[model samples]
Target chain A: MSGRSRSRQSSSVRISDEQITDLVHKLQQLLPEIRNRHSDKVSAAKVLQETCNYIRSLHREVDDLSERLSELLATSDTAQAAIIRSLLTQ
Target chain B: MANSKSAITLLNSTSSRLCFARTSATFASAPPDQLKRQSRRIKMAAYSSMARVAGRRRAWARALLFRLHTRPRHKTLMRRKRRPSTSSDDMVGKLRRLLPGGETMDVCTLLEETANYIHCLSTQVKVMKAISNHHLSKVN
Candidate 1:
């Protein structure tokens, strides 16, 4: 398209969901661009490590509750069944 | 919505303080139940607030990440995401896509930085999910 024609057609360039999806697909098209950062492995690893630590510390209380629930049930099928029933009703 | 990022950032910093206090209180307190309850609140508040911020972040991140990938080498072929529909995510994403190419930093640089930021936000969301589950379990 010539500059004049492109200018005339400017308003026609509308972005939509398909465009977003296409943009996402095209962006993935350049994931190989990530190859350039292989040399920065150390910093990337640090980022990854920090992210992992944050994730690891996220649900300690939840884990505790799950653990305590398990202990309370103590391998008793009846206790487990009751808990499941109560949860489902709620 | 204009203050969403700032609100979340403020929340983030405060939550960190609460989390830190919880840690110290855990060691200082002799009682287990009280310590556990306070610690649980810290986790819940941090997770829920961050998750809200992150939900917005993902919207902006997806658009910014896409713009970062496409470089707009051919003006005619440029594929933009929508009008962002909300505030912070859209603002951040707009700033991202508007950065001039063949200028100082390359598209790859900006995209990577934004991607890393988005990745960090997602990690926070996961943590929030875990905390919420924990809180719910306790209520039961």
Candidate 2:
């Protein structure tokens, strides 16, 4: 009975060591994937930020164009009214 | 016979009058200066529409980034906690108690769990890549 229990204990230690070795190997395999994922996320975020900046610039340009259009329309309307009034008086 | 001829003449005169009225109406509605201004207004409208579309795409990209940022982080790998050293037997005993199985079974379960974690990470990365592509296409 003493010999049998001693053999079982040693077997258990071997099994545990094998399990630990397998876990370490799996972890090592995952390291590259983790690093790649981190880099991808960083690059994606940078692109997204640049897109936002470009959109903001486009919005500003649209606003400026609309303002200028409004000013041009108002001046044209006044000039047309003046021309019609002068023709009427003549 | 005279009444029919007069009716035909009246019809011809009215057609000519209608044509003149149409031309005069067009001229009054769109003079040279007004036509130029109208074209400019149309061009501005097109640009504004393009800007609105760009703004919408930006919002979508921003939301995607927000979701990615809010995802549950890998806490175990991200933050390593220091622990006091223990004997190999004690550590194995603790693992056995936590795992509630023999060595082979414990190893299988741990491998399965790590595989699932990696799978989840891969899916998240795919989603981020897709979002990035979408943003790039919209920008172009």
For lDDT, the strongest prediction is 1
Put down candidate 1 lDDT per residue, B1-140, tens digits, no spaces.
Answer: 64444454534543454445344443332355554455444444443444345443333334433443454533312234546455543333343544322123323333433444434444444443443344356546
List, residue by residue over B22-130, the lDDT tens digit for candidate 2: 2333233355555444434423333322223222223222222333345353331111253554753343333322221223334434343333333333332332233
TM-score of each: 0.25, 0.24
Query: In model 1, which residue pairs have backbone atoms overlapping below 3 Å?
Result: A62-B134
What candidate 1 gets wrong by more than 4 Å, as runs, is: A1-90, B1-18, B21-105
List native contact recovery per candidate, as a fraction of 1.
Answer: 0.00, 0.02
Candidate 2's error at B120, in angstroms?
2.4
Against the true structure, whose TM-score is highest?
1
List lDDT for all candidates, in order. 0.39, 0.35
In candidate 2, what are the lDDT values of residues A1-90, reduced to their tens digit?
A: 221133434556545656645554544444442333433243422322332233334434434433343333333323333332332233
Q: After superposition, how far is residue A72 of candidate 1 from its true place, in Å?
A: 23
